[model samples]
Target chain A: MAEKTLSEVNERIRDGSVRVVTAEEMPSIVDELGPAGAVREVDVVTTGTFGAMCSSGLFLNLGHSDPPIKIGRAWLNKVEAYGGVAAVDLFLGATQPSIDRGIEYGGAHVMEDLVSGKAIEVEAEGVGTDCYPQLGLETTLRLEDFNQATMVNPRNAYQRYNAATNSSQRTIHTYMGTLLPRMGNVHYSGAGVLNPISNDPSFQYIGMGVRIFLAGSQGYIIGSGTQHNPQAGFATLMVTGDLKQMDRRFLRAATFTRYGSSLYLGIGVPIPILNERLALSTAVRDRDIEVPVVDYGVPRRDRPSMAKVNYEQLKSGMVRIGRQEVATSSLSSLLMAREVAATLKGSIEKGEFVLTQPVAPLSLAGSARPMKQTKEFPYVEDVMSREVVSVTEDISVAEAAQAIIKSKFDHLPVVNSAGVLCGIITTWDISKAVADGTISQVSQIMTRNVFSTTPDQPIELAARTLDTHSISALPVVDQDGRVIGMLSSNHLSRLFAGRRPR
Target chain B: MKLLLRVAPGIVRKPLIASVILETGALVNIERASIDAVSGEIVLDVSQEKCRQVKDALERLGVDVILLEIPVIRDDSECVHCGACVAICPTGTFHFEDWRVVGEPGRCVQCGACVTACPHRALRLVLK
Candidate 1:
């Protein structure tokens, strides 16, 4: 009987066949060719899967797939962009490429700015429970940066929560990753000028990625996950099925894959291939009854630590119900798998490969040419903060008025010798005092022990504070009672009116 | 099916990233064709310099490092006195004694080399 491989199934793929072929010696493809193709042969070898995921870095096995990107061009692009065309506009009055892209992809989607050659990343913080595990990550895919040694970045990254052996009572974290956008690139050293893609200065290249985890055991299989890259959508696929209780060594795997751009027919290194369905089904059925560990490539000793325990024994133990419940729950498993599949399909449709999009266009999409949106937002610093001014009791009204004008504010903090933000003196305060002819040293007319809000209080709350106090300006203070910025009543008006401050 | 625990090897590769940090090693193209045989022995062929990296990784996991080398030799002079084998000896085991990068089977693991290096077709690996 012939053994069935993933590629064999790919041959029978009816629209959704994800190709899993061992493509070593796949021709070194160089997108920006000069002399020697900027890449070499790409090889995909398997090591026994599973790392204990020690400290700092997350580890995993990407059984047999890899991402392709040349390194030299990536390096060159990074260097060239340093003070290139974009730098001039960024310094002068040119609308940057990123500004245009920001408008195109909208604040919700982050594309790469060709001028900068870096993708903007969005942190997925408070989405939901299901969205927590696979926090969204995203970047632009510059296929043109392909290298000769077709780079194969295995889909291997997991957080430190892969519970394995004692996972039932204690979780063995089989997968974990602490960082996102782990990049890989290939630098070709070939001296010959070959393809006419780009100049030779582009010697280095770049590719970006994220982390994921998959697990099975305890009578539950998880092909279910909830995450999607916002711009270039993506989703995880898992398989759960019951195997016949036979007594032979076997293999069972449910593969979820994405078919890449046009694939070459010829295989790598001596080209050998083979597959079959019924034979595979039989092979899967006759496996020994030992439970399989969900491999997420965590480092050794750190992964889900396994202990010797038979499924039959677990069933006998009075943990939950009898052996009947231990078998399987058709409805729950089916519903989870369906939901996961639906998410995957939706992501593919929406291009949410990593779940979130950048607030700007800072990726390799090259759409970052000088334009309106790519320019740094003139109002971001202001929106993220308040403009503040301060004054002192010893200063005369004339001095306070001068301080407000010098600080480019209508108000200044009126502090005493203690430097405490006692009261706020705005242009109006000084003007009124001056007009009433009762104005002396600022202390004589200044308000006392006036209330102030923390810098982080929402604009709406600050507005409410101003309206309640009938004040035109509110002093923004820090925890130590230090005045940081001024939340002018005018600023609140702008916010409430939905005006993006210039 | 009987479950087997295959520890994924930890491969660390350093790049020129502000004093490169240790990362998963370079991924070799693992062919699924290895399953086509009943032979369970793992074959690793890399430069002697790289062999240390692989050896160190496996040894950390407590794997007994059993290496194979040529187990036979004729007259040390019949060594073809040629340097073909020297070019490929990962361990740099071959060196010039008398204008000859001659190799002795005693220093050789079962890895057949002097056998193939003999352009005169005098050498052959005596596989045990």
Candidate 2:
């Protein structure tokens, strides 16, 4: 049981005599040399994960304007940034969408633009004070214009995350990405074997003030991330780094379709091989780690888990859910994760970065709890019939009529060539077509201006829309205008009666 | 070169793809076909040099032809080659080559699946 401390590893790194390997490479090395041999040979194992972390943001100290008043509100490139901290300081949240452009552009984009050396539009309003009388200021500011730009992410790396799938009849857009219907695809985040927190699951070396890599910049672990549920194996990290020193290649602003905006940044951490136990932990492989496959179609906080799958199956590009084989995609970039780990390893080998002992160990006691709700008002998704049957616009009127009859539904939503919502055909429309002796295509008689509702909309709103339009049902659509389900008045009445429709 | 051919209801039953291969001597790889009584849409791949000939041939058969030109555009500045597109593409149009995502535009059928799957918002599908 060979043992070494962080100071010993730092000493080796300083002398350019440290042996470093990536988390991906550590598994093979441990198998060849065994845990004891690996402890003797390897000084550090670098781990990395590059993924969408919506809870990440930046703390910027905008240099004081002339006669600056106490800032009450701030907007960076039309995306709102919180200015409650101080007179010249603001916190730019990555998930904040633009007030005008919405999710198409956001705080994440502003942060990326600033880091890319693009001038950002900064607008602030302040109430006039006795000492500082400036009311409002609108100016363009670059990353260099700020006195200090630091990334203080409340949640960064997750030890492991469940893969997402959709069991509902229609595709659902979520933070996990677009989940195809009936388990058509599995979307998973986290770098698995290359994950920093996963490699150091017990948080032995990772704690407060641990030196690490953050988006190609040197950073430190501040504390445990919010919702740090260690017992469920969902450990997270809160980190801080010099945002001005980060590389644009490792930092990106992203929009997840109907979900909202998120930030994708690279993070890597070095684990010192203190002993055989530490070496064994670093050598954990993708096959050894198992995560649940959660069905996001439920649209609930505690979505049902369909199955338990490992990273190996997920990375292999497909996973089995019941009797069907579903394709899998990773929202986290393993390629970029690999690059982060390699870069960190090179930095340590070149004596540019050194390991540091944690100032305080992360607490392992706290768990996440759901927010309490006063009333349970159902959304369109809760009452809508997910098993929707649709027909293509090119289908003949006779075929559309047959499909509507067979499905026992009066309305049949017509989709275009790309499966986007185009029109809706009703039994009455089909009957009129037959009586006219022009029973050609569904496009002839189908309602082109059909009203629709989203899954997240309140059931009351959906009911109002239906009543306003004088329609029996409203097709539930995604952001891309694709039909996912049907929300009929009958379903709402059933819900009101305390009975859920199948 | 990939193409999306929209055949009118009058010519929907005809073997226009066979005629294109026979007349222009171009190799046509039919990737996907959705046809009904009203209209038909076929996605096919052909050589770059023979693309013009194939389009002209299909047009002569009363088929509306569109030469698919990068249906899914990956913004190099925004894309980090994360492999989300590679895994979600049903046709396997995108693959990892040397740690970077390489797209085979000829294989893309304009499903727009990758556009939604891309977390970076780097990929966009443009269908004119």
Candidate 3:
């Protein structure tokens, strides 16, 4: 049976008789020796992943100031930290961008700087109270200045994630990295066979209180992470560790162009080979795992999966998607993952780290649920102006100008004789026409390319349309292609204002 | 040596690269080119001795010649040979050899893709 327990493994580790191998080496060792023989020979198989995790942060307790201010608002290195917790405790989310540097510098950078032993600028404001009289604070402090700085990541080390590609005309900057236009490139995350959860798919060995290597520090899995969907193979883990013990090599800050900030962290989990099942599980290879190739161009809740590819194909640096060979990139660093795994293995073999069985197994029943829309008016039809004032294309510039002046609308939709939207003209266009007396007909000055929306579309889509085109309004049309209403930015602003409670 | 030539809209239609080769007897190996009727940019490889002659010849035709000399600088101390820059480099500048990243700095066209994609901040773009 070749069975062992956590305590047995720890005893072997302490006695300098433990055998530890990295996930990369375990599969080959399993091939040389079957699962039963492998279990007898191997004590632990270490797995690791280094990728951008946005849902990671630091919980810091800055000891009370001399005046004893309760920080209502706080900033670390110009990046905002959540001050909604206790009086002195603050949570700095990795993805929160700096007020001045935007995505270039953020909470992730602050965390890295802290790990690098650099000084951080702190600014806080507090509401004055009898016991805590200080109203504002401005000071500089290092990572050691805080009473406690703990790394409490919410969701990390996804079991498996989809590869991303773009089918649109332009490049999209996503958390997956820059997906080139027309499937020019593919970006996939996850450390494949080297991922901890991937090695233990059913959560048999990984659960609450499982010890792990988080950013080069000893960490523990607190519970199933947020959006942990084991059914879909996208399981996640929530972990916590001491920030001061973390190494900068395993912690970094990254910025996706057009997207926001994220923390690049390394996590390693050592699986004690307790039995044949655990031994066989650690032998999973890159070719054994498959993930969907999601199209980032399709902006929706459920994006379309263009194809399925194994990690081997992704690691080969190219994958075929609909007859096109796309160059593939990995958002997670495999080299770093290997380094982390090797480091963990060395730590275990050196008897510096020991294994512990989880007190409670993680729950794999719940599925990830999309946020339900609860707004009173979610569609463009609910907020659009019903009485739209439009002019036919044949109308003179003077007549269109008169209608716009009388209606006091900045934009006027120009329609064909059959009442189909043909063009649009703004007050600025009319003023340009008036300045240059050559324009007589509305068609001469009216912009032929008009951006419009549909009545059945969601208000967010309409808002996106207006925002993407840099326009203040969109003519909402029906299924028959007739302008039924106008959705102006003013209407959207008013809708938001009306929805807000006074 | 690698060079990035920005041909003006007015001179994009001219056979500039052909002219430079014909005039100086230098070989121009174009690495990448995106040319249209309006304007064009070309990345080409040439010998070190011939690079100065080519640049002078192109500059005489009002073409903007930028000598791409070590455009992307790799900090060996920070780089872990992650290969994160390998798949995104349009010119295949960084590649894996024995499971470690190797950089061919001459092939890079200064796109800055690898610079941004690098997780360790090990690569930087120093345009000279």
As a TM-score, model 2 comes out at 0.80
Off by over 4 Å in 3: A380-456, A471-502, B4-22, B25-50, B59-66, B76-84, B116-122
- lDDT tens digits, residue span A126-197, model 1: 222332232222233231221110112121111111112222221111111111111110001100111000
Clashes within 3 Å, all models in order: 105, 0, 0
Q: Classify candidate 2 by CAPRI docking class.
A: acceptable
Provide the global lDDT of candidate 2 against the true structure.
0.87
| lDDT by residue (tens digit), candidate 3, A1-502 | 8898989999999999999999988999899999999999998999999888999989999998989998899999999999988789999999999999998888999999999999999999997889989999999999999999999999999998999988977766787877778888888888899999999988878999999999999999998899999888889999999999999999988777678888989999999899999988899999999999999987777889999999999989889998999988777778889989999988998999988789887787756899877855578877778777899878888998898986636889988777788899999999999899998889899888788888777788789878877899888877777887888898888877875211
Native contact recovery (fnat) for each candidate is 0.00, 0.61, 0.32
Instruction: Report the poorest 10 consecutive residues by lDDT, candidate 1 chain B.
Output: B12-21
Give residue A181's lDDT in candidate 1 (0 to 100): 15
* Proportion of true inter-chain contacts also present in candidate 3: 0.32
Q: Judging by DockQ, tell me the better candidate of 1 and 2.
A: 2
